[model samples]
Target: MMMVGKPVYGIAKSRSAFAQAMKSQAPQQTLDDLFAAVARQVPEFGGMFLGDNEETLQVYLSVVSPTKVVAVQKAIVAVFGTSVIPKGGVKALQGQYGFLQLKDWYDRMTGPILRVSGVTFTDIAEGRNHLAIGIGKPEVESRVIEQLQKLAIPRESVVIEVSGPIETLTHTVRMPNSMSPWPYLRAGGYILTRLLCNQTGVGISQATLGFNIIGPSLGAGFVTASHATAAWWKLDTIAGFPPADFYQASGYYPPHLVGRETVDPHGFTGGACPTGLICRYSDSAFVRYNSNVKFGVGHIARTTGITTSVTSPILTIDHGGSPSGEFLIVAAPSVPYLTGLTLNKVGHYTGWTQGKIQMTNANFSQIPSAYIQVGCPGGLADPTMPPAGATLLSQYVVGDPTNDVVHSGDSGSPVFRSLKGLALRRAELYGIVWARFAGTYKQFIFSPIGGVPFQPTGVKTDLPPFRYCDASASPPC
Candidate 1:
């Protein structure tokens, strides 16, 4: 890599004012300008982030081989201009099609059985590059290694660590509802009452709205865990009635449409076990916002208690000085897991809970094939097990065993990371609560947005546009 000594730009008067003015621009906008310019210069960009100082921007360039680093670096400098490319800022990492090679390899080796839980790359004292993997169990790990060997992955090229148990986290919907009392506040993560069940009882369960989605079909609506809305997927009329004066997180009850039930054209049954790793092929559904009803963004609410073992405090969304434009939380792509990153979630049952990401790109075998249901009658394609080595599986696994951070109505609650600290910070959407380990109290599972299938039927909504933060923050943050 060629080192470009720091090139100084002409200093302007009132430096603080200039910096403040720049900060006033939406963070997303700043990211766009930098990345767009960088892409025009070097097309093979993978990802970028704020370095330790939160000012030095590190731009990742995916290279086919180590020898191409200099050429790519030159191209970047030629396009970005000398001063724009921070001194010693460009990282020319070798990977496939602009992604880390091991990242691609982990996706391939795990097949559909294991979601690639987490990935990390580092060079230690000996100066040898080490790739760490958060794999599941020995049974699954052995199978993954066999696949790696077929790809010629020498044992030395990687290190594997057991993540959470290899077994699938229990799907919350598949279990019995706790029938917890509904809260007064309506928000993204809460229990929506009176789902008519085919069984002998009215379905009383919990769910969360992952985010608001807008497309051509209707001006706006929200998406939630597919299984949470599974009962309504194939039917139009809700057989049971909700409590009078009842409203949902969206501030409206189910519409009276005769034949319109929640649909999941991409439910678990679709094929090869559609789960959260890929949103398009996920266990999620969309509920069109009923224009006739009034709604408000009440903000996600939860209890401040750590778990049932401790006393709880009522918790609600903490508004901060930062003005979160348009969306409070935006989608993030799946990547290797970082051990100690703190994650926050607000749900109808748990209220407010903070935990660490135990695994990423995790896989679960417990998806009962019977639960699969595509949106259309005949279904998109005959459901089948996805072939091994398919490149599209990524999701999250909350490995903590004691917190019970989520519960019955928690499915679909937004999973996010606060920008600064937990008190009051802008959050980057990571995934949505989907499942958990049956007997475990704290373990939770989520679907990563990056793996969400792109381009579904119905009026199309463009992938949320990328906005730049002044600090070089990018999407999939």
Candidate 2:
């Protein structure tokens, strides 16, 4: 959770003042901490939202049984002075739940059932009351439903989705690196920016570097689809071959594929883990920035040759690169996961596109072996699944029925909150783009940065630069 300053008692001395602060949106972290504190104090905390006037922070507690709603409000008032209207009783609290708490309960209850063959992924709904499970094979739906019934999940709150067959989503045929012919050379090294191409020369298809991130232990590292590196790692380790390089356009000859290193998949011998060199999760990989190679950070491109920087918490409204000159400020991790929000991604094939988050806490098991072996390498699987604990979420953008929200080369693009008008310095990194539904518009599967398990072998720090967006959005300063 994002750390918040001490609540100001004087400012909220009056309920009207408190409402005014909320109206300003008062920074997402402030609101998040308030809700988190209340939920933590009361296990039965259900859900919270702004009242019709948009000033009152309305809270609801579980009405499974009678609740002291007024007493709870008084207690909260004594501490924060924030205006709240507590609603109780079964009727009022129907379908309400504490998202984090309920998700934890579901995870605890369904561990064994998750390992079933057809169970691809599972996640608590954004609303906290609903649960969704991705079923790979339709035939196993009955058994899954029976298992859930035994576990006591309400039938109406559960949604079973079909995510297609058991095949791995890895696209193995490598494409030509798509750098411009006349690449810019800076400071005696090839300086590449957005749209400069990259790849592992093996059978894997070429992909574009999405953006770069900075952390304490490392320099800027390029980010991309995890499958690109995973596919190469298998070949690199078993066949003793080298991975591909990042490239700028070479004027005379074919663009030189500069020698790039494989950080995650870090090689199959060591399944991808969070290292200063490479952090892999969400079907995405981070490649250490080699000063010798000289690649710049930030700057994403659209199909129309326009570009924007990722350094700020912002997103351009137009997808085709025709600059709308309008940018949507990003929200912090305090408000990390939400459905029905617009999201954007940049990739080697599909330049840029937008979509909405269809679900949260999505579960997936039928993934490439690389993810299964994460943080363990040659050892037995880690037992923890790729997205099981808060590390991932899924989204589907219904485009014009022609363009995909994301494509194979687009993996590793950051999925961020857009158009909320929240204030911030740079684009908030929400989750890493990984896989997509085959033959459908469900183009991206994302892993939240917060829930990733850092292996003891790599850089021991949380994901860098954006670590604040991790588990609770509050990282040690």
Candidate 3:
């Protein structure tokens, strides 16, 4: 990691001024400059990771407050037991570069904005090294812009940032990913798919197969959400699991690392792990089979060379979508659980995906209750594509009306890509889910996503206009 500091040059100065002025005044800041700057600063974004040149890592960030970053850090600590990412901005870092190195900040989720640049600087409390103010160069702006265009996230959803520059900054105003002060979901934790389920008797056969995701825990011993309390893997490795959890709730839940359990304490079985340790969620429930023993952690099955969770991602089923309704279970792909074939849930956001919906002639199920129809945000991937008549709702799935896909109790579950490979955030949503469908599908679903608990902007356009309290009363707080 090299740190270079110099006076801003002519081209750099001009680009910096233009970017700064635009960022300062413009409601939506473009990141073309920030990404390019990082690339010019480091080669990781420039395909250096791929043995390619001139390609700087193209990093795009959706605006987040320092405070929220800290809260998410806490959630990461509380939910996902693993230091999965470095101490500072691991998720953010992954978005910037193609991959992240975990060994550096194993206990925390923090790091520099860009790593490929090999530019390192220690924090200075009173004296220096805190270049949080601005980018010091302009030549880097082009690379940032180029990468931004290449990464292709929504312009309205990004706030461009670059390192090594003082004024080479861009602010891209975006729809808030989290609405509430608390984060919705914490990175990789055991996810649950919470739907109508009668887990007791004859109902188990008629149970509605909900969606979900689950992560391994180091304390919970085995898994939850399964028919049994312990969610032990049926087969080793992710090749068997589906997603993260068996029960999927929508709210904020982090990942947990299960302790390794080596079989023979007296060298009876063989190999290294004789008895594995135990992993648990913040709830203090033991999760996986072995805790201390690290598996053959390898890069995800993408060409990106990113590592993946060696254990199977779990899924949860929502009997009612609550701590009571939720149960954690392993989604071993090879084990076989889901009844229907997973469809391609397409959307524009890299961390966002949608489910293939078949419009029915029955009635607008969501309408007057949970209606997601035409005119929704990111409505259609291809309005002119094959599925012309069917409409894509604003939300990826039907969630609680006040909040959607899920609400207060519905945090921490994976908005899964059961069929897709575990690469690229696996093209999944990585935040809190706080809304549900309030209308019927026969009509259309309109989504109004806010920071965390954002409500529908105008769902009652059909009903009489009425003025009411916008938020829950906090006892006249």
Model 2 lDDT, residue 113, Cα: 53
Off by over 4 Å in 3: 1-403, 420-477
**Candidate 2 overall lDDT versus native:** 0.40
RMSD of each: 11.2, 10.7, 25.4
For all candidates in order, the CA lDDT equals 0.39, 0.40, 0.19
- Candidate 3 lDDT over 1-477, as tens digits, reads 011001001111232342232222112111222223433433333111100111221122223345534444443333222221222232322223211111112111112222112111111100111111112244544543444355443233223323231110000001111323322221122222211111111110100111221222122222121111111211111222122222211222212222221110001111211112111101111123333323211101111111111121112212242222111111211100011112121110111222221111000011011111222122221011111111111122221212112211222223333323322222212112222222221111111111011112322111111111111211100
Q: What lDDT tens digits, residue by residue, belong to model 2 across residues 243-277?
A: 43444322112454333544433321122221111
Q: State how far residue 330 of model 2 sits from its true place (Å).
A: 9.3
Candidate 2's TM-score reads: 0.58
Q: In model 2, where do residues sit more than 4 Å from their true spots? A: 1-44, 47-93, 96-101, 149-157, 165-204, 230-235, 238-240, 244-259, 265-281, 289-294, 303-334, 366-404, 418-426, 449-477
TM-score of each: 0.51, 0.58, 0.18
- What is the C-alpha lDDT profile of model 1 across 208-279, one tens digit per residue? 555544444434455566555423222122323221122352222333211122334432222333333322
